[model samples]
Each structure stands twice: as C-alpha cells, then as structure tokens.
Target: MSDFDIKSFLTTLTQRAGVYRMYAADDELLYVGKAKNLKNRVSSYFRARGLNAKTVALVSHIHHIEVTVTASEAEALLLEQTLIKQHRPQYNILLKDDKSYPYLHLSDHNYPLLAYRRGKKRKSGRYFGPYPNATAVRESLNYLQRLFLLRNCEDSYFNHRSRPCLQYEIKRCSAPCVGHISQQGYDDSVRQATLFLQGKAAELLRELQQTMMAASEALEFERAAALRDQIELLRQIQEKQFVDSGQGEADVWAMTDWQNVLCIHRLVFRQGRLLASKNYYPRNPAGDDDTELLAGFIAQFYLADHAQEGVPKEVVAELPAETMEPITEALRLSIGRRVSHSRGQRGQNRKWLVMAQENARTGAQAQVSGRQESARKLEEVKQLLHLSDAPARIECFDISHAQGEATYASCVVYGAEGLMKDRYRRFSIRDVAAGDDYAALEQATRRHLTRLKEQDDLPGLLLIDGGKGQVARVAEVLEELAISTVALFGISKGETRKSGWEFLWEAGAATPIMPEAHNEGFRLLQWVRDEAHRFAITGHRKARAKSRSQSDLESLEGVGPKRRKELLLYFGSLRNMRGAPKEELEKVPGISKKLAEQIFIQLHGE
Candidate 1:
C-alpha cells in the first residue's frame, strides 16, 4: 500500500483519461489500471469493500503517488498488462517460479525432426505444448522420439553420419539419412508418434509392448530388448491415471485470494494421467473480483507460451459464467481443440479442484513473505534520492569495458520496492569510437532516451553510477533531447572509493548523503550501485565474446570477407567451425571439397 491517503485525495475528474497505478510500500507496482476519468476512477479505490486482509495490508504501505495522463482506457488496459508482465507487481496474480514453458519442436528438414525445447522460439519448426512444466513436455518428447526414431541430430552431423548412429544400433532409429531404414518405415514411425501425442499414449504403449513380446518369441533378442526399454520408459511415466473419468486430455485451474494477493494452480491431465501441477501468484488484485482476476491470469499465462502442444479437450476453471465462452474460443483456435471449463460437482474430481485452490492459497502467502527484503531496500532508495514522490519504478545505469574494448552499457530496473530483472537491458557501444568512455556513455544514453520517448512509459527516476562528470553528461544528453521532468543523478565513490563516503552529484557541487554505520538510505544506494555494476560487467563480457568471434573469422585465410560470413552463418559460430571436419565444411555455399580440406588442415593440422 502507498503512503498516499486515498481517503484524503478527492476526485475532480481532472482529465478525460490517464493511467493509474496502485503500489505498495516496497514500491512494487501492485496493480496498474486505466480510467476514462483519471481522478474519478482512481478515487473509487478508497471506497471499495470485501477486499481481502492481504489487500488492506498492501494499502497500508502507500507513501507516494504519480500519474501519467493517457487519452484512452483501452490504452490504459494495454499499458497495465504490459507493465504487470514487465514489473510483475505484487497485487496482480502472477505466474510463479517457472522461467519458461516447454514445447515439442518439429525441426525443419526434408525428413523432418522432433525434439523438446524451451526459451524463445527462434528456430523454424512446428512447436507445441507449453505443457505444465518442462518435465511433462520432456516425457512426451521422449515417448515421441522412441516411437518416431526421426533423427534428432543437428543437420550437419546427420549429413556426415556415414554409418548408422547409436540410435540405429539400438533400434530406436531407422537412420534414414544414412539409408539404413526405408522411407516407408520412417513415415510409419512419424505417424505413431503423432497419435501418441494426441491422447493415444495408452494404445501406443500396448502396441509397442505386443511388438516386443512377438520379437522375443521370434528370437530377435536385440530388437526385443530395445522395445522392452521403450515400453518400460513409457509405463513408468504419468503414473497418476484417472480410471473413473472418461479418457481425454484436459486442464483444471483453480484460484484463491489471500490478503490482497491471488494464487492460481493448474492441474494438467494428458492422455488420462495427471501430467503436471503448477502454481501462479498474481499481485494487487485490490477492488477486483475473483472472477475477473482468474480470467485475466488465464489469458496472459497461455499467451506467454502459445507454442505448447496438447491443448486439453477441456479447461476447467472456477470463474463466472460470462468468461467461459471467450476463453474457450480463444484457446480453441490457438490449440485447435474443443476447450471448455467445468465446475466440480462431488466425488474425487471435486476434491482435486479443492486441492488446486489450496495450492493457490499457499503460494500467495509464500510470495508475500518473500517480498519483504526487496521492499525495505526500495523504501531506502526513495529516501536517498530525495524524490518529491517516492519512486515506484527506478532505473539505474552502468558502463563496463576491458581497456575500452568491447564497451557496453546496462540498464536495470527496480519497481514498487524490488528489482524487476526481466526488464533489464544491455546496449553494445555502437556508433561510438572504441575506448572513448564519454562517447560510449553519450551513445547509450541517447538510444535509451529515444526509445523512452517512443514508448508510453518511463522510469520514475534515472540514476547513473559515477560522480559529477557522469551526472552532468546524462543531463546534457537529456537537455539535447528536449526532455524535461526527469529525475537525474549520479552516485560517486566514498572515502577511499569505499561504500560509506559516497556523494550524490548535483549541479555545481557534490552533495553528501554518506552512509553512517547503519543508514538505510546508504545501504540501499550501495545495493543499487552494486547491482548495476554486475549487470554492466556481464554485458561487457558478452560483447567481448562477440568481438572475439568476429576477429577469429577475420583472421582465417581464404575465408576472406564473403566466405567468412557464409561459414559463420552455416556453422553458427567460429567454435562450430573449429569442430567441423572437411566434409562438413564443404557444404558451405562458396566452399569446394578441395578448399574445405585445406581449411580443415589449416585450422586443425589434420
């Protein structure tokens, strides 16, 4: 809760539209909502009732407020979700713990390929899942790989496999690229894999088991052993099967609010077994009803990783009647399945739904407890900056380099009282002459400023990690860009460049806000400065690696300008090239077999 008294501030409907944010003491943006009347909508929060005890606690923390007027409520909602996802405020129900969802990726090739993947979907392929967790999707992929036997090897490696790989010797693969298996056998394997993913795992397993028994009876021991292994693996997976319910894939989501926080838990049953269970905690759901929060959480959660496979035939969630159709239609199109939500009626199924709700309650409580330290640190920052309003969103910058080579700048943000690491950004010192610190600083600042102008949101405060010189430099950049109303400052080193004596750089003089032995403000700035330094150093390391790769390519003889690029693109990097044999190198567009052999010898002395 912010310190700003919602009870005291009166609504004048001062603006037709604007973005309103509700934040807690830790400066963590709890909830961001837009209004048709900026003041009227914001003022309404003071009178809302039935708010959870947790919600009241958060409201108690409000110390300051700021507003950015927009022209539309639609713009406000859009900004709200974006910031919620970006900062992940405490009051909004947020997906928990998982860094990313998993997917089953079918690789690009004439033969095609299948594998389990996570992170950004940059490669060309048909991806599915975003299953409850990585393990569930991975189990599914293992089943498919064993059934399909499609080559999972990288293209270049598969191309160079003159003999059948271990997968072939083990009978899991037909080794089509090396011609050990006929095109027909490979196609049959692909068909079975698809069926297993489409709620036919049990049927597929029975067929595979039967084949194993037949092979053993025919004295094909090796073939039988391979089949036996696949059978055992499949049997061991997804042990929590539902015998009473009709066999089909489905997802069950349940939500509960504790204090002002909401938690959602999902139980995913795929192929009639409980595949995975997950929990999500969303922030500052103050004044928002349970049904609304549940609806919004489900939409954003699914969108975050839409490529996952196995859309449950039904999605069971505890929500109001109105949300059901829109959710069903939206998911149906994305997953190509008939999606529906169910309310628990009695029996074991009803108990499971209760279990999902309990999970949500526990998760929300844990998150609120864990947020304490970060909140205290944020309050300290507010005091140290002497900001007119305590900044709920603060952005800090730092520069790093090794002897001025491969210079880089990093920006890290803290919101509502803690760091939002995902919004962190790194900028390569482009357009700046190498080794020129001032030029690098100027370039990075301008790029950041320009983007901020284009984007609808900006940080509440901007901090640079240096003395007066750095502060002055940033101010000049802002002035040149004609931006006003931005809080800017620099942090200078203390006595002997230690923590305690640091000064805040102001125009014309260095103002001291040195930390006493236990000053909260001093400790807070130290933490921020340290975090910025770490982020900047990490960026500098990455930039140096990229530079080294380019230098390596430039040094290769006969690789010249055009051929160098072709090699890098084909192989991905110099490391890949160094590992490549002559035969692999010959595939690069401009490289002949003779030239490839020369390269192999020159690089490896082979």
Candidate 2:
C-alpha cells in the first residue's frame, strides 16, 4: 500500500543479523526490530500473503526502511532494545516500566547496617542482589536482621542513640547503636549475612554450625543457645525455600494473551530459591505470536544494562528449541558465558514454568479490566481543556539551571498511552544571557518548532512550565515561525508554592485560569510539567558537573594544551596556580607579563 520501493530495497538488503527501522513519509519512526537475517525478516512484512492485519496496517504507512548490521544476533538484539527505548516507534511493542531494580546495600562502617537501596550506586559499600523488586529486597533485609541481628538504623541515628532501641528489645537488632554488640562480633554477623546474600548459604550454615559446637564445648551456654537458634532459623529457611542442590541460578518466563491483552510473567531463582516474580505488559501493535513476542522480550530483558549484573545460568520457557537457539547464542555473547535454555518438560523446572504461565494469564486478565481507566482519564482531560476533540499529543517545556550556568531546556511528550520518553528532547541554552529564562525559552521553542514545521508533525497542545511571561515569549516565537495550529498555555506555582495549587495562563490571556485541584485535566497538566522540570534538571546537573570537572584554565584566552601543561608543572597543581600572584605567574616559561596579569585577573576576579 505504501510507495516504499520494497523490491529495490530488498535487493540491497544483507542476510546478516542486524537491526531495521521503518519510517513514515513524515519521517516519523514506525517500528524498530532485530532479525537473524535482515533480508528475510524484513521481507516477511512485504510478502503477498500471510501478513497479519496489524502488520499490513504498519506496512501501509511505511515510507522506507533503514538497516544496521551487527557482528552477531546478540549484538543486534542489544542495539534493537536501545533504539526501541530511545524512539518507541509506533509499530513496535513497548515496555512501559523503566525503573531500576532495587538492591540490598551494606554500608562501609565498623558496624554496617543492611538497608534497601535503589537507583545509582554512589555510596561506599557492598551491594548485593539486584532483586526483581523492592519487596524482595525488603524481605531479604528482614530475614538477615532476624538471623544475624545486624543494625538496620541509619548512621546518624546509631551515632546519637543513648540506649538500646525497640528493635533491640524485639530481638531484631543486637543494639550496635548502644555498644551491646562488639565490633568484632558484629563483623562476624555481617560476614555471615554477606555470604547468605552471595548465594553461599551452605558454606555459611556450616560455619555457623561449627561455631555453635565450639561454644557448647567451651561451656558458654548462652552463646551456644544463640548460635543454635540461628542455625535452626537458617535450616527452616532452606526447607521453606525449596533449596535445590543442583541449580545455582535460572529464570522462568511465561507469556499469555487474553482478549488481545498480552502479559509476560517472570520468576527469578537464585541459589535454588525463588527470589521474586515480575509481570510485564508490552504494547504489541504488530500482533506478533507467542514465539516472536517471547523471543523479543527475552532479548530486551536480559540485554538491558540493569539486567547485566543478574544474568542467570539458564532460562526456562515453553518456546520451541529452534526459536531459543538464537536467543541462547545472543545471551552467551552478551554475558561471556553459555546460558542454557530449557523447555521445562518435567521436575522443578516444569513446576516453575507452570506457575509463570498461570501468573501471565492472570496478569493479562487484570490488564484487560483496567484498560478503560486510561480512556476515561483522557476524556476528562479533553473536557477540562475545552477541546473539541481529545488531543493526540501534548508537549511541555521547562527550563533549569544553577544560578546562571549550565542552562538547559527540556521538552517532554505525552500521548494517549502516557509519557512518550522517546519523543523527549533537551536543548542546551546557548547565546542567551545566563539565567535569562525568556530568551532561553524563545531560542528552544524557535528551534523545536522549526524542526516540527519541516516534518509537518506538530503537537496539538504546547505547555510551558512558567507564568504568563514565559507563555508570551514562546507565543512570539510561534508567530515568528508563522505557526498557529498549536494551543499554548503556561503552568506556574501558586502563592503557596505547593502542588495542586498551581495557576495556568492561557496564551494571549491577561489573567491565569484556575482549575480545581481534583480536576483530572489539571492533574495531567501537572504530570507533564513535572516531567519536563525533572528532565531539564537532570540535563543541567550533568552539564554542570562536566563543566566543573574540566580545567579552569581551558576557558582562558591564549591557553592551549602546551601552556596548560607548563602552568601545571610550574605550580604543581591548580590550587597552587590559583594562589600564585601575577609576579609569580610571570616566572613560568613562555608566560609574558601581560598574559600573567590577564590570567591572574580572570582566575582571581581582581
């Protein structure tokens, strides 16, 4: 149906495994996919027969296709996931969940505390178990506290404690805060807990048993009883967890569809114990069958950067052996080890597989029930905004900076489904005076609108994260660009400077529009504005950090690499150089008196 020149394109396609992207006439991304053979997989979409309804619909809009060759199918899979996350093409199945997995963090302290942590790992400590979810991390922390009695209190709280707290009375903590447990004794407990978390439970249990025996032989009855109780708890955990001596680590996956809603359930197993379970509902616009969907999910799941630390030794699924071969090969290429694939025909593997399958079915049914809520909310947004038709797309802009430096403008996109992260963009504010938000907004809007005008793809509504002044500035840009199809509005914090008390300024209006706090449309606007603010802040922080990390002398005129090296060597460090007077700077090789004075004035603001 599309004038894509499929025959000409196929002739030039390669047979190697790689990634392919489809685009519409307007240059909008339609889909991104990986294939074992680029030539064959892409050809399937254009065949005369056997094409599904959704695939045909996608092909009908295809203007052209682009391909990137990779060394292996595994590499292609990784690249495919990265592009999908970045662009989120219309014809591809998109996984909405993006939060990082949680971990059990052990602080680097004399008496360390085991705590649940998420996000970037910047703290100095040992991190273990990038568990499936926060609940798994918390449950593990509770078990460790019960068995080892390690402190879970914050360092500040521990430092200021005057006496044993309620946790000590309840027997969950040994009250390291009150010196009830010696540093050496707490260190031993920490070691045992670490061992258990590292999946060396048998080794830890044996060590605990030996310690208990020694205590009993030394006539330390109380110490022996405590050790014995710990051993019993460990044994109970082993039994209840269904510990299998043979299996070290594995993941079981099951996918099911109910009323066109698809769900994938995953069960993670580490050290023969079930760690946690997760459910994913990806939007499948092309209507891929079970095998294709399962394979895609596997590639995206295991190849993600967050998942690299937790790749298992095996995977259990119901997919055909042929379908799993490439997946196994790709995973091996990614993790530097051969990860076997199992059909889960019998024994414990089969049982885990069955559980995952049932969970997937249940999750799909639940998703079907909740599908209408999103539509209802969208309708409410339409009524609140007084739009004749529900908007297909909404874009918001926000500006962020530290004082007058490292300014960044962020544009976030929201569509019918929700936040469209792939469509988000950040513009570094340049040529404008630092901290001049009006000029920054004008520049960013001019650039963004110029591009949209070329592509003929403009959003229905444009929102600004500021008061009427900001909206007027952007409106001027729109007028300059001769674009008027988009409706413009601005959001500003109310006098209280709190959420749910925000004022909105419609374009060309002298006053702000105050919507009720509980209005769904107002809440949607709040969500988009907050997202834009967050994105801008993140970009600004990264730019600020990078600017700070660079040498201060780089910004000075007439300072090249050779001059910088000479200056550093003469002064030994930047700190010493900054302290140098103009006379002292003049003594450095190739440093003229005038240049030294200039450098001194710039560095010291003298």
Error of 2 at 378 (Å): 3.4
lDDT of 2 by residue, 1-606 (tens): 565556545643556566688889997989988887888999999899998999989999988666654434543554566567657887888876567878888999888888888778978899986764444356557767899998889877989999999999999999988789888988988888888888887687668767877998999989878876776566434332222223558888999865445788887777765444557888777768788988888888887754633888989999888998988898888779999989999766875686678557655543432324335655766787677777678899999999989999999987654556668999999998988999999999999999999999999889999998999999999999999788888999989999889998888888888999867778778878988998898788667767878646676667778989767545545665664434457656789877987887666532
Candidate 1 C-alpha lDDT tens digits along 211-323: 87699899999988777666545443422223213355667788875433467777665554443455666674265677877887778777566415446676677676578
Q: Local distance difference test, per candidate?
A: 0.64, 0.76
All models, RMSD in angstroms: 21.7, 25.0
In angstroms, the error of model 2 at 406 is 0.8
Backbone clash tally (model 1): 36
Query: Which regions of candidate 1 deviate over 4 angstroms?
Result: 1-376, 454-456, 499-501, 550-606
